[model samples]
Target chain A: MRPGHEEIKDKLPEYISTGNIPDDVKEHLRSCDKCSQEAFLLQELNKVQVPEPGGLFFETLPQKVRASVRQKKKGFLFRFVPVFTLIALVVVTGYIYHTITPPLTEEELFTDPFAIQVFDLSGLSEDDIPPISVDIADDEIYLTEETSLYREFASLSSEEMEDLYEALEIKNRNGGVL
Target chain B: MDVKQTRYAEDLRLIEKYLGGDEYAVEELVMKYQRKVYSLAYRMTGDIEDSKDVTQKTFLQVFANIRGFRKKSSFYTWLYRIAMNTCLNHLKKKGNDTLELNESIAGSNGNALPALIKEERSSFIRGSLKKLPDRQKTAVTLRAYEELSLKETAEVMKCSEGAVKAHYHNGMKRLKEILSASADSPGRKGEGI
Candidate 1:
């Protein structure tokens, strides 16, 4: 409870072990009953004898430790192998599923069944439909010639147009025979 | 580097080698620190067999967790920390079934009498030490017996130096009281140091 007894008490363990206290602290310890008692008890505690293991114990300990750890390592694998296998199985299953099953496109998702029935009735498979190319050049819509039956019709001469109209008239009169 | 730092560096190298699959490094490391770890474990448990178990567990734990041992603290301090934890856990689970003093003390080769006396003194001291709380017991063990510096003790105990001082001081007072009480009791006086 003196001005420096607290400090001396803090250093008492070191002092007890090695007698490394400063002279002033030693003086404080000498004068302070509580600090001196603490020092004594710590010194006594420091004298406690732990039984030493025999020479063979030290000599064989590393081997024992390594063997135990190796055993545990095997046990660790034993415990986790199933979990790892399950994880790998799940991953492989997921990869196969993704590899074989393509994702649906927007057109596939929203295709009309009625339109498909109409195409079936027309006896025209989807592959029979010409692919259309639209150009928006010069602020005007232009359908490519390959995709445009209207462009072919417009390119026909007047005599060929008359012949085609007469043939379509005769087929119409015969109830859509053409 | 100083001797301590040099040892730390050597310990780190051995640890790296062990981690790199060199089994001989394990032997080297265990050979290097087994005695120190055993001594601490003995003090903590107050029984030789328990100390051995604790020492084995400590090394196993150190090897098991060695990869996580960032070189932030000295390898010695980290080892002490693991050893201390292993000792505490061993005592916690085993409940400190210290051997009987008569059965525990082994006779030395040359002089039986001084050896017996020293063993008896040690037994009394360990009994008193067992009476202290865990933290206090650890503080006293590390600071007083192990001869670690206060800073090193704090690092091992994973507390500040101030807390180490407080725990050690309180432990000393409590130890003195225990010794005094034991000394005052009949038939226990001559056995004490």
Candidate 2:
């Protein structure tokens, strides 16, 4: 049967601690078989003591095991330190390399005199010259058209061109703008 | 100093020394709190061996992470939190089912009936505790066994006082039911309830 007399039955443990049980509830507990049995059971349950673990148990943990555990922990740390250091070094080195290298400039690619020849075509338009088809065959210059000037110019090396320019400088002194 | 006062003073000194980076302070700290930690672990795990393992692991974790422990909480509270978590994780890994209570004490089975009954009850309580939801078990253990106040239990549980109260009430009610069932069982008659 549900104890409809009071809600204090549900809170019996708390009320028991404070010794403030109402007279009606106290009378119910004193007379009611079920509630009294439950109260006795709770009292017995409360008195159940947990056994303390043996005193010597903790003391019995071998010193060697403790040392080994300590050693294993130290070993893990020691093993990690060098790997961490290497990673840090690689990252720093990569950062420094990236920061120090300069970018490529356009002047570096275009400044070589050998890479281009400037033609004095001040009075010439794109249509004045015959279309000359030049082919490099067997490491020798080949022109599809048999032109004397083309043969002469192609036969001279870059050093020979410098020599011709020097000779033309002397000739230009004798005859200006020739 | 009186024995209790001297021990308290020593615990404080050890805490200060640990903060000061003395290596032995950790050892002293472990020595001081091992029983409390082990008992808590054992009560939570329901196995002496598992409790010992959990206790060791808890101390090692505490030692490693002590630097992160702010002084806002008491050292014991922080330590208990670590121990509780470690025990819970261990229980979870083992599948959080009911653990069998050992029939023999220290490999012997000739103890008195009342003592055996009490032992069985204690083991039942420990097993029942595992069956509880994590927060409820923690709140119940901290309040009942550790005798921490509701406020202190809340602080350790990282919950509001009302939550702790609810957990405690529900946990105790469940425990009473479990114990009552076990007491009425025919197999437990030898336990002399």
Candidate 3:
């Protein structure tokens, strides 16, 4: 009676490792010529050793192979440096943009356009005018009585007032006002 | 001192030096393992020239990627993995069936059997190994020749232990059949089992 094929194949490594063949398996191996031959072949094959590539092997290797190898290694890093540098450059540019550029506020945006509005005297009448002498100091601005005739100049629109203010050298004391 | 012990100590020291940025350490490493790496390459590719190329490429890869090595595996095992990968890639590029038996085995003189056969049964075993499939060949070579444990072989081969076992068993079985048949060929006399 032959041992099953799967059983024999599975147990073969165990047998080879331990050299402990079971009684029935051994009997079956002996009787079944194919299995017996396979066993013999396995035993013979085990005797084979792996051959060394032999000494003096490295002597035959390419001369200064290490130099070429190191060069190739450097080549790999060199290839990636440009890409890494580009990435770093982009990141730094982004950081600088974020840090140096001030954030725009809603108040600044709205107030900047209306800056001239502060100089408007639209609701003031002649009676509402305080004596110019009271507000103007002589050292800052000489408000001569003759210049008081120009006080009604406030009735002009801002564009017209800007034109007249630039025409006179009188240092339009309140020219900056809207 | 035992050769393996002396070599192992030297290798460890060189690896330490290499990690420390000693450029010469790479050369020392190449010198130490070049033969083993070349032999593995030859076995995997069955071409002496290709094996040399593979060995060189393997060392290059090892040195280039050394920083990534976590020391979880032995240096030789790591080197073997590189050599195997290099050879496999070469084989794949060249097509697996393009494996020429005569390339590695042939010498200046006609099929140099005497030189190859003198190494007891090892040459015969190596010859038989060439007949197995590529994966089986790799598994058997690592397991039997490299003397790696089943687990280590599996790790190197990137397969399960059961898969390694299957490749190993099938490889051994094929080698047995081939060796037996070759031994019994017409020109050869029936030899001792």
Candidate 4:
């Protein structure tokens, strides 16, 4: 075989089919028995019969393809919808956690420091307490105010109180008040 | 219009319908290309059920991303690319050791097919095919058996034309060697499983 026989032999089928074979390559096929055999072998290999695929191979494929597409699309939104829902749920949970929680009471806020102050060691005696004056005149004004409702009520007789109560009860028993 | 032009137009119409919210158009597109997609996947993967899975996966991906298609290539070209990718990805996930078939897989049917001899030869060819490197195998299956043009194969492969040429060359060369060697070997029967 020639030095470049492999390259020419590789292209032999294509060139022969296209009818543009050069003379030098033709001479190579003629002179090199090995190259000739390779070309012949390729032709024979091409002739090796490949049978049509068994079953309704072609006819069933389209339905299978459609079913597959439908299957994918069926879950297209389902795939991401849950993720969004989870995110929203997390955010709402966090918000409610912050907003609905009660504020700390003053006692609760000062518990640590106030605990020390609450157990005071200091005790004061009653003798150390300051004296305070009573204003009896101010207290007397309530009794002396002649036109006040309190004074008038205080002046009411026991019999007058019973008569007033009886009149009020009579008005209450009347369902015609409206 | 010519058949080529008509196919393109029809593909465009279906795509428009799908984009306009007619999901049934996706079914139409599937009906149009499912056989081609499945056959390509089956040829590349060499497994009937696996190829069906790949075909289903490819169409799902297609409709999922169909709106992104810019009509730069024919719809079939785009569909073929998705189908090829799905098959190759499926192959990768199954791993490189998966290239060799296991015993349980071959006898899996327990002689389900009526024509045992023909099934055996078919299995032999598939086993030999898996021995090719993935890209080369893809190129050989698409071009030789699937009858895709070099351009279409390149498009499906998402590679330069020269790369397709090289892949097909190396692939065909290796296939010839493998086929010839298998033919000469008495032990070839076990290789199918």
The fnat score for candidate 3 comes to: 0.20
DockQ, each predicted model: 0.30, 0.07, 0.12, 0.12
Candidate 2 segments whose C-alpha is farther than 4 A from its true place: A1-56, A60-178, B1-12, B98-122, B125-127, B182-193
lDDT of 3 by residue, B78-191 (tens): 778878888888888877763323332222322222222333355545556665778888877776556566777777887788998889776755655454444435454223
Error of 2 at B29 (Å): 0.7
Instruction: Using TM-score, give the best candidate's number.
Output: 1
* Worst ten in a row by lDDT for model 4 chain B: B106-115
Candidate 2 accuracy as lDDT: 0.65
TM match of model 4 to true structure? 0.56
lDDT of 1 by residue, B1-193 (tens): 8878899989999988878877778888999999889988888887788888888889999888988999999988999999999888888797755332331122212122222333346677777677677888899899887768889999999999999988987766565554554444457755743
Tell me the spans in candidate 3 whose CA falls farther than 4 Å from its real position: A1-57, A60-63, A73-178, B1-10, B98-128, B177-193
- The collision pairs in model 1 are none
TM-score of predicted chain B versus true chain B for each candidate: 0.84, 0.76, 0.73, 0.83
Estimate TM-scores for all models: 0.63, 0.53, 0.52, 0.56
In model 1, what lDDT does residue B66 have? 86
User: Against the true structure, whose lDDT is highest?
Assistant: 1
Candidate 1: segments with Cα more than 4 A from true spot = A1-8, A19-29, A73-178, B96-120, B191-193
Q: Candidates ranked by TM-score, best first?
A: 1, 4, 2, 3
- Alpha-carbon RMSD, each predicted model: 12.2, 15.4, 14.7, 20.5
lDDT of 2 by residue, A1-178 (tens): 4445334444555445344566777788878654554454345444545555675767754332345446766887898898999999999999997789664345743786444434468998768876454453553444345565778888999999999898899889978653
Across B38-142, the per-residue lDDT of candidate 4 in tens digits comes to 777776777778887787788889988987888988888888888888988998897754443232332132122222323245566566777788888887777
